[model samples]
Target: MNIWNLNLRHLRALTSIARLGSISAAAEAINLTQPAITQALAKLEIQLGQLLFERHANGMTATPAALLLAPRIERALAHIASQRVTMAQLRALIMLADHGSYATASTATALAQPSLHRAIGDLSVALKRELVDRRGKGIMLTDQGRRIVRTFRLARAELEAGLTELASLQGVETGRITVGAMPLARARLLPSAVSAFYRAYPDVRINIVEGSFQELIEPLRDGELDLMIGALRDPSPGADVLQQPLFADRPVVLGRVGHPLSLTSVTISDLALYPWTVPAPGAPLRVQWEKMFTDADVQLPNVPIECGSVITIRQILLESDFLTLLSPDQVAVELEAGWLTKIADTPEGLRRTIGITTRHGWRPTGMQNAFIQLLGEVAL
Candidate 1:
């Protein structure tokens, strides 16, 4: 179901009724008439197709559906943190923040530009804060606007999760999991887990977005991604993210199968003689590559190409004498095909932890948890 179709005020009324146990008390709490609160509850039940409350002689008793949903609704509202912000305002601002232009946001939402503009203007007035600023041909979100957008995204996630749980209760499994995958995870870990998960929940959709850690972190924080899988950073990426190590991966020096360095034993001095292709600066692989030279007391080698793409690096290695440090898993196919060979292990058996990263307090639905369990099983 499209959660945006439901009224935020009605959702608030539902939570209030669940807490207060009577229509009169709930209406008094949210400043609505008793009849209005009753209508809101009835409308919510009809929309959700579940009996939210059981009428009794003394008061209303919440059904299982309401028990599941009320806390989610309360948490979502806490993220919003504003009694004055309307659903229309939240939708408009989020669209503008995501698309970066009123015209594009209008096209995306199928709303008239004037309506979007009015909604944003009303939102700014209600919140008593500036959300957007005109810059050249477009507008940009203020810092406050970005913070609001993040919270709104999280709120939407909570509601979507609640709906997913409700659907599961009805024996209907539904929801999407967006995963941010770095190179190592893409090569084997993610594919194995996804295949196992699909066999169990065929109807759920899984989306894998491939990028470096720098590229995927923001989306993971903003609730655009369910989780990220890749090399774990040394000093946690931030206070808001949690990392779980699935396994340890040791990198190898890769070269063309017939390259000069393909000997059984290779030295750092031997490695320094060849031109290298490494990931861009700040990448975990690049850091390990640098440390290899430092530990051996050898000057860093000349890196002719700084790249993060395994395919590009593989093609270059096959065509020329460029060596790179990579997890063997990343080049397993090339090794099996005899297109590339591991020249040597990284110095001192340097290893990076491969794992999952997620928002610190994320609460995954049952399907999501099952997928995570599958990842652990596949790792084992």
Candidate 2:
């Protein structure tokens, strides 16, 4: 169901009624007449196609639907933090924030430019804050505007999650899970888990967005992604994200199949006597690579290329005598095809923790939880 179709005020009334246990009390709390609150509940029930309350002489008791929806409504409202903002205004501002221009936002939403302008203007007045500022031919959100946009995105997620849960209770499997995947996870971990999950929940959609951690972290924080899978960072990425270690991946020194290092017992000095292609500085693999040279008291090798793409690195390794540090899983196909071979183990058995990262307090829908379980099973 499109959450935009439901009235925010009615949703508030539902939560209020559930909390207060009576229509008159809820009406008094929200400063509405009892009849108005009753009508709001009635409308909500009809829209949801579920009975929300059981009437009694003493008070109204919440039904299963209300019990399921009320907490989500409460949490969503808390994220919104204002009863004065309307859904139209929220939609307008979010579009403006995303698209960055009145004309562009109108084109994207099919909303009239004047309507979009009015909605944002009215919203700013209601919130007592200037949300957007004119800058040359374009516009930009003020800091306050950006904060509100993030909160609104989170609020929408909560409502959508509630709807997904409701659908599950009715034996309908639906909803989408957006995953942010870094290099190593994409190679094998993510694909294996996704294959198993798809077999069990064929109706659910999964979107895997591939990028480095730097490229994907903000989107994950903004509620655009359900989770990220990759090597964990030392000193956790931030207080807002939680990492779960699935397995320890010890990287190996890799080169072309007939490289000199592959034919003999390799030492750190022997490994350092060649040009290397490694991840950009500050990457987990790069840090480990640096530490290997540091421990050996050998000068770092001449790195002609700073790269993160395994496919490109593989091509470079196959065509030239270059070495790189990588998880064996990342190049499993090439290893099996004789296109690449392990030159040596990373010195001293240095290993990186491969894991899943998610919002610190995220509550996954049942389908999302099931997928996470599958990831753990595959890792084992």
Candidate 3:
């Protein structure tokens, strides 16, 4: 079905008819004639390739398709509305959301109360939903209105990014890249690439978000992250994102500079006697740490901390005798600074592919592509 034919008027007709249960009521709600509302519903059904409602003697009964499509239609309408909406209206909405009152929103936006009200009303009309409601002394966003606000924020970010890229094409190079950094990238890889990219394009803004796999994937899929850097997941990471291998890194046991394990030739069993700081259970590094003990017929060590932060883990290693298995790339700077040392060799065949994760079909802008190329240079 060609979605372009299904306009806001058609969507409004569908939602109103489903909610009010009659064409006449739907017409009155949207300020359209009964026949116009009826025609809109017919056109919507044709474009969607499904029946939305069944007509009865008394009124229209919503079909399963109608129920399924209502919320989606609302979201789609909101997204479309966000594009057509003016900056003043969006600014008014944001201020209204923050202040929770039309008077305060007007104060913040430096617009008159009626102007602020009109802006919000225009946006509400575009989205076909009431955005805010008055309570005792404050205003609140409706559930659908919250969704619109969230989507509009994302839209604003994308628009800003696009404008930044447009400026970059003229050789100005002022832009922002939001990177989702997994444990490995936070250590050395991202820092090195960021430094190099900054040297070349100092005007570019780089924001790194640190997270575990579970925490970062959704943001990557939602266009919130330009790309994710860290270990590649086996099998495909669903069909929404593409994983590109940049390098392979093996786990290395690390400790304080003069720790007991660093002085002696150590076996996995010999190292298992001490307290350890390992990755959280089910992490790629944690899985490899367990397998190391299994191969050597050793019991797992007492894990005082199952940490995911390389920064925190490095601090722990610096302050204590606890040992941990991690990718060497995660501690290159600390190792170079002589604060930590590699205590034991990783088990043979214990290696993970570190790579980049980006949404499928995502196209990088000029500066984004340049930063990605810089990552390739810094990666092993």
Candidate 1 minimal-lDDT segment of 10 residues = 344-353
Candidate 1 lDDT by residue in tens digits, 1-380? 88888899999999998999998899999999999998988888999999999998798999999999998889889999998988888899889988989999999999999999999999999989899998998799999999989998888888998998889889999889999999999999999999999999999999999999999999999888999999999989899999999999899999998999896578899999999999887888888999999988999999989999999999999999999999888999999999999898876668888999999989898899999999999988
**Candidate 1 deviant stretches above 4 angstroms:** none
- What C-alpha lDDT, on a 0 to 100 scale, does residue 198 get in candidate 1? 93
**Pairs of residues at least 3 apart in sequence or in different chains that clash in candidate 2:** none
Runs of candidate 3 with Cα error greater than 4 angstroms are: 1-154, 235-237, 295-298
Q: Please report the TM-score between candidate 1 and the true structure.
A: 0.97
Q: What's each prediction's TM-score? A: 0.97, 0.96, 0.64
RMSD of each: 1.3, 1.5, 11.7
Which pairs in model 3 have colliding backbones? none
* CA lDDT scores, all candidates in order: 0.92, 0.91, 0.78
By TM-score, who's the top model here?
1
Model 3 poorest 10 in a row by lDDT:
1-10
